[model samples]
Target: GAGVSQSPRYKVAKRGQDVALRCDPISGHVSLFWYQQALGQGPEFLTYFQNEAQLDKSGLPSDRFFAERPEGSVSTLKIQRTQQEDSAVYLCASSKTTGPGYTFGSGTRLTVV
Candidate 1:
C-alpha cells in the first residue's frame, strides 16, 4: 500500500460486543502506530510496533484492548466488551522511522451503543 489503510470505515457495536479493526501499512515501513481520538480531542497513542515486534503498549486503556503486527505489515486492534466510552475514531499510521514522515489512515469510527 502507498499509505496506511484501515478497513470498515465505520462501525456500530452494541455495548459489551467485541470489535476488530484492521490496518495495512505502506510497504517496507518500519514503524506502525495505533491511536484513539475522541470527538474533540487529538489522537492519543494506543500502541506501537517496529516490524514484527511490539515496542509499546502503554496506552491501551485496559486488558480488553489488544493489538498485533505479526508480519510487521498488517496490524489489528481488537477491543473486547465495547463500552460507550470506546466510541471514537481509531487511527493507524506508518513511517519509515520513529519521529516523522508518517502516513495516517483515514481511521475507523466505532460507536458503542
Candidate 2:
C-alpha cells in the first residue's frame, strides 16, 4: 500500500461484544504499532511488532485486547467484552526505525455502547 490503511473508520459495538479492527501498513515497513486515543487525549501505545515479532504489549489495558502482525505487513486488533469506556480511536502506525517520525493511519473510531 502507498500508505497505512485502517478499516471501519467508525465502529459501534454493544457492551460485552467483541470487535476486530484491521490495519494495512505501508509496504515493506519493518515496524508496526497500535495505539488507543481516548477523547481529548493523546494516543497511547498499545502494542508494537517488528516484522511479525511482538516486541511490546505493556500498554494494552487488559487481556481482552490482542494484536498480531503475522506477515509483518497487515495487522488486526481484537477487543473482547467491550465496554463503554472502550470508546476511542484505534490508531495504527508504521516506521522503519524506532526513531523520530511515524506514518499513522486515519484510525478506527470504536464506540462501545
Candidate 3:
C-alpha cells in the first residue's frame, strides 16, 4: 500500500462485544504504532511494534487491549470487551524508524453503546 490503511472506518459496538481493528502499514516500514484518541483530546499512545516484536505496550490502558504485528507489516488491535469509555478513534501510524516521519492512517472510529 502507498500509505497506512485501516479497516472498518466506523464501528458501532454494543457493550461487552469484542472488536478487532486492522491496520496495514506501508510496505517496508519497520515501526508501527497504535494510538487511542478520545473526543477532543490528542492521540494517546497505546503500543508500538518493530518488526513483529512488541517494543512498548506500557501505554495500553488495560489488559483488554491487545495489539500484534505478526509479520511486522499488518497489525491488529483488539479490544476484548467494549465499554462506554472505550468509544474513540483508534489510529495507526508507521514509520521507517523511530521518532519521526510517521504516516498515520485515517483511523477507525468506535462507538460503544
Highest-scoring model, TM-score = 3
How far in Å is the alpha carbon of 78 misplaced in model 2? Answer: 0.3
lDDT of all predictions: 0.95, 0.94, 0.95
Listed per candidate, the RMSD to the true structure in angstroms reads 0.8, 0.8, 0.7
By summed lDDT, the worst window of 10 consecutive residues in model 2 runs over 93-102
Clashes of 3: 0
Minimal lDDT window, size 10, model 3: 92-101
- The TM-scores, one per candidate, come to 0.97, 0.97, 0.98
Badly placed stretches (over 4 Å) of model 2 are: none
Output the lDDT of residue 6, model 3.
99
Q: Give the winner by lDDT: 1 or 2.
A: 1
Candidate 1 per-residue lDDT over residues 1-113, each given as its tens digit: 66789998999999999999999998899999999999999999999999989989999999999999998899999999999999999999999888867999999999999
Candidate 2 structure quality by residue, lDDT tens digits, 31-103 = 8999999999999999999989999999999999999998888999999999999999999999977754889
Give the lDDT ranking, best first: 3, 1, 2
Better of 1 and 3 by TM-score: 3
lDDT of 2 at 59: 95
